[model samples]
Target: MAAPAATAAPSVPPSLSLPPSQFARIQPHAYLLAHLSPPSASNQPSIRANGRAPSQFRVTSANAGSLTHTNGSAVVRIGDTAAVCGVRAELLHTEDIASWSVSQASSSNKRRRLADLGEKPTEEDEDEDPEDDRAHIEDLNLLVPNISLSTGCAPGFIPGAAPSALAQSLSHQILSLLHSTRLVRADDLRVWYQQPNLGPEEPERHNENEQMDVDAEQSATIEDKPREIKAFWVLHIDIMIISLAGNPFDAAWAAVLAALRDTKLPKAWWDVDNETIVCSDSVSDARKLSLRGLPVASSFGVFEADAAAGWRANVIPDATEQTQTGKKGSPERWILADPDGYEEGLIQERACIVVDKQKDGKTTIVKMEKNGGWTVDTEDLRQLVEISAQRWDEMKRILDQC
Candidate 1:
């Protein structure tokens, strides 16, 4: 008998509901132009959908500790975009955890050695860590975050299928921010417990000046070590896409931050006789998770609209010229905050900034990501910083209230 014929895959991508030609890119300005534009010759928009200015954010609502079963939970809504985040704390045995620094160091060294053999670390592993001392290395696998874009949340998602590329990419970005920013320190999660060394810690040389009986002296030489462990707490962060209007990053991050603020670990104690750990059930005995910094992220979309620029080239502009300059760009360049699904569709560029305020009241940028083939200069960066600073403060207040 001949071998079975191979099955061919579908030609059309599952992500597309209809053929590409059927979709027409319609921006917010297209619908809001009349309402937003000045009555003069310039029909340029000063407002977007629902009367929102470029830098203005949609109304936001947040609720924390909504899930009783979870260690912590929060629901965040920004305009139509919504996200529900739940954090679960689980116990891990010391033997099961590995030092991340050690593994990464070894991996880098091996790559470099391979580079010397035939490849080069400079080319392949420039962004990778060169090497590090493993003696004091700490394990950082304590926190894990997973984002899901369910079929119910979006049109492109398929039920019960492998994670979509968007979900995977978002998850990776979240994990990277957690690691690169050092927002949550491994030292905070570590459960400290020490074991006793029954044998003599020092040399058993005879002491001529000893006064006690031989057996009594030997027994009294040392005390039993305290019961403890060098273990750490593991966090499972699951964020569900409740509703995605746009700007999932900001909504999801808000949910996560709020949920973490609500997290509390049960008080645990070592049971020497049973050789296990025991946790207290009383709520008062619980301890709050140590957080290094409260970081907030904001995303902006840059749309390349054709604004009128006749006055822009002139050395001087009279009243008429200055007046006409306002009408220069139609669908002109606009920097939108918290873009919705429709605006996101027409965006030519995107940028995200994560920041937190220090004890001295100064804002600090933790991480920044830019993508989508947009060009940005120093002035754009400055604007981003200003916007992020305001949003970061607002977020901190909201989390506090929650």
Candidate 2:
């Protein structure tokens, strides 16, 4: 006669509305719309009682080097959502299309000068195809939002499928954003293919007595060339939703920045004489991508009823209590920052706004998408830009800690 186990409380049936299948289509968004909004300050978690607000974000943690084989890797956990990013690099030759770019010209001149200075043409170069002797160019690829939905996160999987469509879309969005922005460069990460045709009596071979002079001359030529500019690097980022708390866009952006901060690219060697490629394995020789600064996201909830009144919306960096409460929730709607899962179900309408600030102090709204029913006016858009710019510098400083 075993005692009966205590029964758990009955839970609400999972709603079929807005299923994962549909989410996959929109997850790549720059700003994920979160519908969760506290009915009032009193309805939020205890943290709000401790002076925290309903829109406040949870502690975000970042770590790197989880995977050793990848060129570079990093992980960021914002509350329950966790994302990992890995960087891999490959060396490629300059395409025939852009054979005369600045990189090609500079590398070509260096190699020719090296040959003239009497350094023995390495054996590798001796075996190179005469046609392949032309200058080399390199390109970079970055893969992101490789979604891995851990069992610990949710039971929203579509049986017999890999990642949901939402996951793929998110990954693609991040990769596209990173690539179009030129945040990394592949040309600089080239690893020379060490040509194998240099003969002992090659024209560039230096006599023993002239070895020191040749070395000096080659060094001088290399010194004359300006360092290569790396527009962006290829990276693979895997984002796992450990908790579907809501606002995937903001969490993803934070994760992307964290992954990039720790990502490293291999060092490259150029066959300056032949405008060729060379990659290095030594960490000391590798380079890092120069990010344009953090691009944070904000979202607004427009009530379906507010369509007639014209729902006002803007993206701001540092919002004050006055600004936040400038408009109250009507039967129509409201805009909020970083909404969580529960609030989404409660709201009738929503929209997301994202901003990226250039080094010159100009802010660009890279993304805007909304659901439910509301339209924004120019005056509201202008206010959002001002708010985003004001907070850009400060947000960057905090995000730099990652």
Candidate 3:
């Protein structure tokens, strides 16, 4: 009876303890905000939940020629987001294109008129006519890019499912950028054939005059027949999301850029005997694509401090209190670079800047897209562009090494 009287109940701690992972899972917004806006007295630099500075980007690594079967292939990883891209070149004969003849004739007539005017077309002229290049690629569908996100790469993406909206949107974005940048030149994709000039039969004459006349006729006949485009190399660009933590566009585009840079198209020619195009089997005869510029993409997210739960909200002074005290308050908003999945869910505003650095140390903005919120302004865009320039350099160096 005495032994059963007192097995003193073990004392329990006042509060329950939770692992960081569990805490993050339970209160994602508050967890991220706590890291981003630590106490002023803690003397800690503001960092993201992933332990990166507000403007810090994840480490990027790339590998080219990863797929031996494809004409060109690359694998790129930016932190947890990974993508693989493969480029396959297929021949599209002029006969297969219903409008090829019409387009070619129109272009030839235009060139002839220009020649008659004694105005030779220059590089600057082509630059001014950007739509010509765009039309060629878009009309012919020379560059076919498709993205797949049904590989169970991330949450909500079931395996073997239909292509999701994200996949469709990404594919469209890639296609638009390809047309706008004119990255791949049509001339490079064209395979030409010189038609044999059959001149009118001339009476046989045993005189030098007759021989000269024959030569003149041959020259005229040859001049009349120009090299014709027999076929074009249609590039099929396929991208697969291996792992998608967040910021998919950047990773996907980087993979495509790397794969295109590593891509080597076989030297092809129109075989007169076979009456078809033939490609050289030797690797030495292959050639790389002449990409126009090294355009790189950088993504960002805007996190509002007030978006977190009230239990863990930071102590932001009221506007009236600040005005009365005449003391400035810290900013309650933050711009995060390369946000991960957790941060992405809580962030409503986002921006992406595609930048290419020129040889003169100037940055050119290929594309600038922002949506979901209006907190980001022109000055913020300028700053983002600068960050994109740095990212461009980093991407260029990685691709060059690959």
Full-model lDDT for every candidate = 0.71, 0.52, 0.85
> Each candidate's root-mean-square deviation in Å?
16.5, 12.9, 4.8
TM-score per model over all chains? 0.70, 0.55, 0.88
Error of 2 at 79 (Å): 3.5
Better of 1 and 3 by TM-score: 3
lDDT of 3 by residue, 137-236 (tens): 7898999999998466887987667788999999999998888777887777878787776664666879988888888988887876667779889999
Best by TM-score: 3
**Arranged by TM-score, best first:** 3, 1, 2
Model 2 sits at a Cα RMSD from the real structure of 12.9
Please report how far candidate 3 places residue 184 from its true position, in Å.
Answer: 1.1
Two-way lDDT contest, 2 vs 3, winner:
3
Q: Considering summed lDDT, which 10 consecutive residues are worst modelled in model 2?
A: 129-138
Clashes of each: 11, 46, 0
Query: Candidate 2 — what's its lDDT?
Result: 0.52
After superposition, candidate 3 runs with Cα above 4 Å error: 1-10, 120-131, 196-206, 308-331
What lDDT does model 3 reach?
0.85
Candidate 2: where is the Cα deviation over 4 Å? Answer: 1-55, 91-145, 158-160, 186-233, 270-278, 303-331, 358-372, 386-395
